[model samples]
Target: MNFDNLKNIYQFAEHFQKEEYWQNLFQHQSSNPLPITNSPSIKNSNIFPVCDMYQKNNYFYIDMELPGMDSNKIQVNLLDNNIIEVKGYYRSLQENCAYYLKERQNLQFIKQIALPNRVEERNLQFSYKNGIYTIYFRQN
Candidate 1:
């Protein structure tokens, strides 16, 4: 066996040996979540919220960044059994405060997450704690 081939084999074996590898593979919805015929929403639609996801057993964990936003304003929905949609706007309650530097104070984000496996629409759960948004889904 050539050195390159042996390296590839060793990497494959190492990947399979780690539980995190499997978890990460399933977490991002089977390696890719690219949608066919992409659609745009809200101006500057190119910006997407940074996120982290993980899969364990049959549960999918999604951690999305949505700082300074009220939980009541956020919306989470399941579409067609595989697509997860998140929509929300952050409106500051303070009206009298004037700032010279204002950035990301008022924000809105709409993003769809695709799952490789079927999900129960009613079983989804979400929690926002300390500027982090965490959503959960179970594979069906």
Candidate 2:
């Protein structure tokens, strides 16, 4: 090929290489957006008082501290792309009982978590005990 053709071919190959590199990088780094606590259930403003998440062998465990809440009041949902949402409410005492000082939070709260990897939706499980909500999922 002539010198001009050779140069043109080289330039096209260089451009293709740059595009491929960027595509690969994006594919590797792109991940689902993490869930945010923007939605608050008015009935329960003190939702998700404390939350923690960890991963083990083929499993993801989410533990949340939800004091003064009954088992029936809390709702847990798993969304597409491995997002977990916890929604619940806490009841307030009707009568004003005399107390020296009360500093505990009692309101509705909503917490959302983004999973590290896709999980089996059907295999999800939840347990509530001692005012703690624990959610378990099998990794996909």
lDDT of 2 by residue, 1-140 (tens): 23644565565456546665556556644473332333333233322355677888977888887766787878878787777777776665546588667656456667667788877667889888887878888777
Model 1 C-alpha lDDT per residue in residues 28-75, reported as the tens digit of each score: 675564333222332334134667778989889988887777788888
Deviating ranges (above 4 Å) for candidate 1? 1-43, 92-94
TM-score of each: 0.60, 0.58
Q: lDDT of each model, Cα atoms only?
A: 0.70, 0.66
For each candidate, C-alpha RMSD in Å? Answer: 16.2, 20.0
What's model 2's lDDT at 3? 65
Find the candidate with the highest TM-score and give its number.
Answer: 1
Whole-model alpha-carbon lDDT for candidate 2: 0.66
Off by over 4 Å in 2: 1-47, 92-96
